[model samples]
Target chain A: MQVYVDGIGILGPGFAGWPASRAVLAGEAPWPGGETEEPSAAILPPNERRRSSALVRWAMHVAEEAIRHADHDPRALATVFASSGGETGVLDQICRSLASPERVLSPTLFHHSVHNAAAGYWGIATGAQHSSTSLSCYDSSFGSGLLEAAAYAEVEQAPVLLVAYDLPPPPSLFPARPLTAGFAVALVLCDRPSRRNLARLKFHLEDVLRDAPDTLADPGIEALRGGNPAARALPLLTAIARRRSSGVRLDYFEEQCLSIEVSPCPP
Target chain B: MVAMTGKIMAPLWISHYTVVTALGRGLDSTFAALRARRSGLRPCDFEDAGLNTYIGRVEGLEDLPITGAELMPFDCRNNRLALLGLRQDGFEEAARAAARRYGAGRIAVILGTSTSGINETEHAYRDRDQDSGVLPAAFLTRYRYTHNTFSLAHFVRSYLGLRGPAAVISTACSSSAKVFASAARFLASGLCDAAIVGGVDSLCLTTLYGFSALDLSSAGPCCPWDEARDGLSLGEAAGFALLERIARTTDSGAVALYGYGESCDGYHMSHPHPEGLGAILAMRGALARAGIKPEAIDYINLHGTATPTNDRVEDLAVNSVFGTATPCSSTKGWTGHTLGAAGITEAVIALLCLTHGFLPETLNTTRPDPALAIRVLIENQERPLGRVLSNIFGFGGNNCSLIFGGL
Candidate 1:
């Protein structure tokens, strides 16, 4: 499948948006690593904004950035939100509540705990009635999400927004699944070529029985890519940032990967 | 901006399908229960959920743990339900047959679940050492397979020996219904030649307590569309359908997915739009995608969860789309609201109605709400059915509508 990347959004440690992360991705600036700042989803109503979890904020923050970069109405685009561990904080809270003698749960927290919370909040924030889906594939979440988005864009002939985000598991569950930090990335993919196209991606599944997925050249970026599932998009993002044709492989499962041939569109 | 996608979608053959719910295993038992108007619901007797509400719990899953050395890692209520569902109606055999016909590498496994194996995680947490605050070592290795949302697809793919793309949609109740749309798109995009689309959600304390917290659980068997309706009866179910892009539909029982539509409520996280705007859009979108008039539909499987608000709102949506002409009913009264699995469960029921010339009435509903304009059938309609529409709405305002027709 092939689709044109029209816009990009990214947020992680020491980076908040596409332009802010471009230098680091292009190998022109030092990797200044630090804790990620809390994203404020002011676009949501005040009540929802207050009720929003960190994961929801991270996903919406990047989704909003991508929509702005693409200069498109958010209401018109279908959306796909992907994550491995969804709403860790909420999960921890629910587990803790269940463990208690009373086993009483907060209604708001219970409702917010669904995997589509981010997509739901996005719809409310933007009044987007377009189709939206939330999905997961563990470490392969990014590749799976990208594949779904690209396929939707091509088959439906519509622009689609794909958001992949994951936050570190709560401390109680960290030992079982240790994630380094929170990371989120969004892409607006279109079936047709446009002046806004950053690159054209041709994707197909490849069987690499023994080979590992592609890794970033920069050590800091590589660590980020390895630490979080959503950060696995670093290599593809870097290739787009460099504006050079390249082949990038993303982990899809144990023995197979998603191979993408990236051809940069002329500026 | 995105373009409106209303063009007619190519129909995909439903080669085989199977379901495991409180009703029973596979098609024959489920059909028997539906015909006899026997609900699978009973008082909550699940593993110490201790809730007052009734539940549609599958029986005997405790002794039926996934025991294979390779599959033991995925031994959980959700996967057990999936195994039970897959082993029925020759679903697994049909999957293998499709793999043989299209190559295992060209068949995708896409499933939907709201809580995939989180029951095991809850147990693991309960076993946590107090002072050390560490989970049991034995449960750590199985965490990925049991707790992660993708475990459903992973286990299904591995069990079926398929090497194709796999994913798990987790958009609450609408998850499985949306899988049909995703599979259709993937097949159209040439990513996969065949697809396994289904969902499984097991009964757990999280949902029991969570819905109790939200005051959405009914103390009795749910009576959708009833004037005295209270709330939903929670249930657990697993269902699967083998889909292939083919025109071979000579069998009388064969049904094809004609169209699917998905949308967001953009209203509230838990509460649906008072006007059912998203529901209307989804229904209209499905009709547009099928390139059929609303009057063409013979039956409507309402997403009537038995909650007063949900039933009334869904009634308004149905009235807006198909009006009172089309007879509609909520099978949730039989299976309870199966959450993520509701989509495929109800979808399979809709297919059964298409194949068998009968429309199931709302099982426990005696009197339809007088305020609602849509026709809520209280008696089963025995007649030839051609096309049917199923609706599934989930938390976070996710809504999906799927249309199925006999070929």
Candidate 2:
């Protein structure tokens, strides 16, 4: 499927926003490895911000940034939020409570445990009534979500926002799925090019047996990409940052990977 | 309110479908239960859950572990239920045949679930060492296979030997229902020719205790639209449907997906919009997409979760869109609310209603709340049905409505 990217939002350990991340991804800046910055979640009402989890905050932050960058009406466009392990920290807490003697779970935590919590919060904060879907594909969640978003844009001939995020699980559950850092990336994609278009992407699924996915050349970014599933978008993001045409393959399924042709559309 | 363009979409043929609920293992048993007006709900006796609420638990899962070395890693109540559902009514053979006809890479597997195999993790957490808080070594397999949301699609795709595009939609109760819309778009975009769309959600402690924490668990069989309706009776179910592009001049008796609409309440997380504004949008959007008026719909399968607030809001929504004239009923009384699987389970029920000419009434709901306005059927209606709409609203205010009609 083909779609034009209008805006980008990214956050990671060393990166903060699209502008800074673009420099790092383009090899023009040093990778300042550190803790991920806490999100303000300014777009959310105060009460919701207080009640929101880290994952929701991270997702909402990027979504807000991308929508602002694209200058699109948040209430008008559809959204797709993808995460490999959604609210793993909250799940861990719930499981621990269930394992305890009292087994008393808080209502807030219980409501926030659903996989679509971020999408829900995004809806509540932005009042976006358009169709929103939350999905997961283990390590390939980003690729899966991108394809879905692109498909929706192409079929509906409308703009769609794709947000992919993942955070490491709590210590007890971390060993099973060892994610190192929190990462999120959001892209506003439309079927047709606009003045805000940053790149055009043509992505399709391919048999993994034919070739392996592309890898990052920088060691630090490569390590980050290997550590977190959402960071798998680094290669494509790099292509966009360089303002050049390139192709990158992303891990999608056990037998299939996504091959994407990225052509920058700089204004 | 979002603008409605009312552009009709091409329908997709539901070539094959099957479901496994507490009603029984196959469509025959399910249809029989509906015909006999019998419910599958029983007293909550699942494992060590001490909650004093009714449940619609699928029996025999304890002895139905997923077999074979390739699938042994996915041995959990959820996947076992999925396998059970796939084995019913020749769905596996039909899916495999479609895979061959379209090529394995040309068919996609899209399924839905709220908590996929969290039951395994709950057990693992219970078995963890107290000192180090370390889970058992065996949990690695469970986490990678059973606990993962994508595990459902992975298991189904691998079991059927299909290597096409696959993903697990986890939008809570609206999960499975949205799979239809996604599958249709994927097919339209030339990503796949045919698709396997379904959902599987098994009973787990998280949902049980979680709902209980919110005081949304009914102590008796769920009674939708009842004046005294209190809370919902949770159930586990798995349902699958094979969707192929409709061919020219299809059989008149065939059931096809005519339209699907998805929207978010953007109001609350657990509670629905007070006036069911989101529900109304979804229903209207669906009707617009199907290119049919409200009167064209003969039967309405309500998402009456039996929760007082939910039923009341849905009542308002239905009345506003289709008015009080359309015959509407909630099937939760028969199979309890299956959460993520509710969409597909109710969808399969709607397809059955289209094929069997049976419009099931709202079971266990005797006294309809007079405050509500929609026509709530408390007794079975046996009439030839053409088009049916099924509603599924979930946490995050996620709402989806699907239209199934005889082509």
Question: i-RMS values of the candidates, in order?
Answer: 2.0, 1.9
Q: Any runs in candidate 1 off by more than 4 Å, and if so which?
A: A205-211, B1-3, B247-250
Clashes of each: 0, 0
Candidate 2 lDDT tens digits, A1-267: 789998888888988998888898888998898888798879999999999999999999889889998888888789999998798889999999999988899988999999999999999998889889999989989988988999989987778999999998889889889998899999999999778899999865443222478888878889898888889888889999998888878876644568888998963
Best by DockQ: 2
Candidate 1 structure quality by residue, lDDT tens digits, B1-407: 22358879998899899899999999999999999999999999988788899999998899898988898998899999999999999999989988998888889888999988888878877888898878788877787888889999989988888888889999999999999999999999888889999999999999999999999988899999898899999999999999988755457677899999888888889999999999988898888888899999999999999999998889888998888989999999899889999999999999899889889999999988888888888998799988899999989899999999987
* Backbone clashes in model 2, listed as residue pairs: none
Superposition TM-score, candidate 1 onto the true structure:
0.98
Residue range A1-267, candidate 1, lDDT tens digits: 799998999999967789978888887787788988888766778888888998999998899889889988888899999999788789888888888788989999898889999999998899888899899999999999998898899988899999999998987778767888899999999999889888999875433211467877767778888889999888899889888899888877877778888999973
List residue ranges in candidate 2 displaced over 4 A: A204-210, B248-252
The two-chain DockQ for each candidate, comma-separated, is 0.68, 0.69
Clashing pairs in 1: none
